[model samples]
Target: MNNPYNVLCIGVNHVPVRRLSKLDYAEKDAKTVAKYFDTLKDKAHVTLLTGENATRTNVLNWVKQCSNIQGKLTVIIFFAGHGSAEKDENNKKLERCLWINSNLDTGPGSHQLKTSEILNLLNNPLHQLIFLIDACYNFDPKQEVSIQDIFKQFKESERMTGLKQYAIISASAVNQGALEDPQLGHGVLTYYFLQTMAGKYTFFLRRKISFFRFLAVLDKRVRNHRFLTDT
Candidate 1:
């Protein structure tokens, strides 16, 4: 496949000593993504950031630099780490956030990378942009925002042009936990997504896979796993 794109893979396995629990396989997840993309050397430029290096500032800087690229560009960002959803005080809706290295501090002003920040940084003049978030989200019943809804809002926002193609895929649905499998040595969603991308578990569809088709296969594969029932 002639995949012309630039890939940024960020994986966070541990926070600073002050924060919560550690993600045992997040670094592995990032490495796996980088390795997979490495095979597409003919069609892509891949950058991998893991552990302490995957800080908010570094990520933001890279995104800004990529936005300045001259010609047609497709940027794919894959984040594997902790994610949370908090109630938006004004809208009374759940807003998603990604825990970066700096978010480890429990101080009064500590901040994680929220959906809005990401949307702003990535809303550049790129041909296509894709986000794959593999993290557990604290879904609230009162105002849970679906993955589609989040991206839709970005499309409608004044900062972004409606013509740009964008896609955001989450590992799990609202109020669900994105579980990792010891057997597979990876997050269940990531495992399936890679498999589908590599054409491992396709349902005999020999044709080229579309983005939505890949999502459908990934969702089905994840739903069928018996051990991943823990939310």
Candidate 2:
């Protein structure tokens, strides 16, 4: 009953291919986010995978392992890496993938971990999954109902069944890009996210950082970023 959430922080900066550009702060950013979760009520456990360790195979395998865990679970998946909305030859649709560490960054889409693939693996009746995507080139993921509605149901019943909760917070809107700031020493999304979590604002001292408040401040600062084009 102690560990309420299983946090997976996946960051891949070292792409082993010429087709994709290397990143500067992805590994650092992933750790930063994982650190935040570690302090979340001391009930959220974290598993971090970065650089070579964050290969597509390993990450998928880790999630698969967690899916087999019994009882109610809140799974938080955070990714900071190179992502794109490119044309998939197989489906002929715009496929979204977060580029992980692998030798094959081209031809086969297996190394490029698809967003849908991750979702499919954790599609259980008793899981509350949150996707905090810090990669570039993303679209708003579709929602079934809303997180609020799910929370209401969860609160009303001690033993709810047959459905799960989902919420996604992307760094940018569709056709937009996210970046790491050289001066800030972190990705734009990560930099501000850490600042807000660090209680830079005067709000946290007065009240615990709830999701709504934290996100409100984060969204405001990100949209107001001078160099950032979209949010």
Candidate 3:
């Protein structure tokens, strides 16, 4: 089969209306990341959409438009910021992830969109869809949240019928929060991802490395950082 003929990358830095607005930062960072994937544009169609101002509607539209893409299609979504999660009643085993937003209510029927929503959106016919979330999911200071738990939940969903082949890489573990380096001025996971792809840590992994290994190496590298914190 031919390689993927299209690519979509979405990145966000700030939650809409919540915390500090970092849409500008996310837009700038997305542009740089888009550059890294520019070589693919010549061989395959690529669409890079990003911003702190990016809403669930924007994401939904992107997913709707890309689902019908012919041939192999690679969809990448990168998120950077704070996130939270809670138990879901309808889906007892699954937890609902909440993206931080200014008007998000902590009570029942809050406004944050669920991960299932995003998953359902990309559950199309793409050859491959990669999800990279660089943010904290549980924000309760008294309690710790497990990033692994959330990831495991998603992993289990793949067993269901009709979902595309997927790979997920998070900035930290279930109980950990992504660290931001004052010196580097970016999330630790983002830094390591860039470094590995830039020939720093992957130098010894042979010339051609698979996406899984790249994420594994990057995960370990981020975990080993000195300023690790639980979010």
lDDT tens digits by residue: candidate 3, 1-231: 123444445556665344434533434444555666666555445566655345556666766777766666666666555555556665544453545332434554444666677777666664566666666554454334365655766544321122338766666444445566755556666677777778844522134675656666776777777445433
Q: How does each model score on TM-score?
A: 0.78, 0.76, 0.70
Ten-residue stretch with the least lDDT total in model 2: 155-164
lDDT of each: 0.69, 0.70, 0.56
* Candidate 1 deviant stretches above 4 angstroms: 1-3, 17-19, 88-93, 103-106, 109-111, 139-164, 200-207, 226-231
Superposed on all Cα atoms, the candidates' RMSDs to the truth, in angstroms, are 5.9, 8.6, 5.9
Predicted candidate 1 versus true structure: per-residue lDDT over 1-231, tens digit per residue: 124678889898776534448878888998998888887587778889898788878888778777767667777888898876655657755566777777345653254777667667665564577778888766445555676655544333221122346767777544456777788899876787778877844421233755566667776777787344644
After superposition on all CA atoms, how large is the RMSD of candidate 1? 5.9
Please state the error at residue 226 of candidate 1 in Å. Answer: 5.6
1-231: candidate 2 lDDT, tens digit per residue:
226788899888877656667889889999988877777656777889998888777788878977888888888788898886655556545555788875444555656787778888987778778677777764334323344433443332211112236666667554467777898988888788778867745222234656656667777887788445433
Model 3 scores a C-alpha lDDT of 0.56
**Over 4 Å off in model 3, which ranges?**
1-6, 16-28, 92-111, 139-164, 200-207, 226-231
Colliding pairs, model 1 = none
Q: Name the top lDDT candidate.
A: 2
User: CA lDDT of 20 in candidate 2?
Assistant: 65
